[model samples]
Target: MSTATLPRTRSRSRVQAPKNPRDYVRIGLWIALAIVMVIWAMPMVFVFLTSIKSEADIFSTSSFAIPGAPEWQNYAEALATGNLMTAGGNSLLIALVKVPVGLFIAAAAAFALSRIRFKYDTLILGAFALGSMVPIQVALGPLFKTILDMGLLNNPLGVILPYIGFGLPMQVFILHGFFTQVPKEIDESVRVDGGGNLRLFLQFILPLSKPALAALFILDFVATWNEYAIALVILQNKASQTVPLAIQSFQSQFTSSYGPLNAFTIMSILPVLIIYLLFQRYFVQGMFTGAVKG
Candidate 1:
């Protein structure tokens, strides 16, 4: 071959590593995530196994042991019980009645705070924020007395009304942030186009705030559904008790029998979980949307 045109002569080759180091960092993150997920999932798995076990197998088996054969009977027992069925019915009814009332009140309050300037706005907002953080234990005595005075003490409405009241402060706080993020021009433009406050709110504001609304509804539903302590206090009648109240009574039986209790416990969690999952996208989006709005 001609000297200049000959195939290039081989020289000692040196290998250079990939320039980006992020590959290793990403791999490490995935590994950490996997470990965390496994750790988190262990308890859920244990609960499922426990639900299937007969009362005899609960303590007899190793604490972390899985059931050899899953018995589906426990779910039937829990679901078939008169008290639980009543409780579930009561909870569903309360949530149905209470959610709209809660949302309406919370949204209206948030809209006022977000859009209108007033002398008491900041003060009232602060009050609501502070009230929302107060531990429920502080209000128990007066609340019980108030419920009794209303003659609704032992019914689901007793619990539902209180849920709305106690739930409002946080709901307003959340919604206020979301509302403040609303474009001011949208409000002014609506007014310019002959829309009043109610029209602007119902036609424009509420539609734009649907994500926040959905998120709030789902959260309130879950919180009200799973609330055991206050429900135990207000709902005295087993026949009219909410789900959490029923779950409490289930504990008494579970002290002697685990099968039905675990099953019922799992049953109680499902509705809340489903609510969360169903609204999860909107929930997460609303959280980010409001937080970043400033």
Candidate 2:
């Protein structure tokens, strides 16, 4: 072979590495995924690490360095320590008891807005929607003062009332859209079969809208559970404080202990995390179903 031809032959025979578009795309995707995973997981990892560190070690050690020994006692103390159990109980009451009431009222309003051609439907629904956009702090002071007048201050219902107010708008918006998408044939058939509005809503609409309602239920629960400002303003007695309040107890005016504080924060957030994971699919589907046109 000619010398130049020999060089060309070697180039043709050389088993080159993959440089195809698909292979390059896959590599880029994995690198992007790893970066994203690290970014998201970093906060959670820090919370967990702080939860397990002793106060002395937490103060002395570099924030980036992992603790030599994990302090499981912080979690125990948080659970068994002062006032936390009571605050946790209060949180449960507000989240569990108030969520159903909020859902029912909001769903009813949505149903009325979507299904009824009442004279005041537009006015009333718009009012509720408008209420959701105002910052909570804007109204909370006056709301609490009014609650005090009603003598419901330091009561579970006081916090619950505000929760319902704030939660209603988003709920109504989601549900009205969902109800609009329901086939009119179902309403006609129900009416033809001697069903009134009440029966129609109860038997058909409620069943059909369960997923949307479930999603709202979880959303409201988390909001109420984590709410601190309204709860602090309303609940004068520590006895009525909720989970966020309980977690706040970890920090003091003079000093905050990171180990116990982070531990308690982790403990407080764990239930919500668990609940979200368990019902994530339903939560996501309900939200999308409510938002999207059929």
Q: Pick the candidate with the highest lDDT.
A: 1
**Would you list the clashing residue pairs of candidate 1?**
none
**Per-candidate TM vs. native?**
0.86, 0.83
Score residue 209 of candidate 1 by CA lDDT: 90
Model 2 Cα lDDT, one tens digit per residue, 1-294:
655544445356777877753678889999999999999999888888988988887778876678888899987876666466788788888888888988899888898899989898888878877877888988887998899999999899988888888888888987897898899999999999999999988899999988888787778878888898898899877778788776666566214657767777777776778878877888888867835454
For model 2, the run of ten residues with the poorest summed lDDT: 2-11
* Per-residue lDDT over 106-169 for candidate 1, one digit per residue giving the tens place of the 0 to 100 score: 9999988988898999999999999899888888899999999999877777888888888999
Q: Pick the candidate with the highest TM-score.
A: 1
Question: What lDDT does candidate 1 reach at residue 280?
Answer: 91
**Worst 10-residue lDDT window, candidate 1:** 285-294
Structure candidate 2, residue pairs in collision: none
Regions of model 1 farther than 4 Å from truth: 1-20, 23-29, 291-294
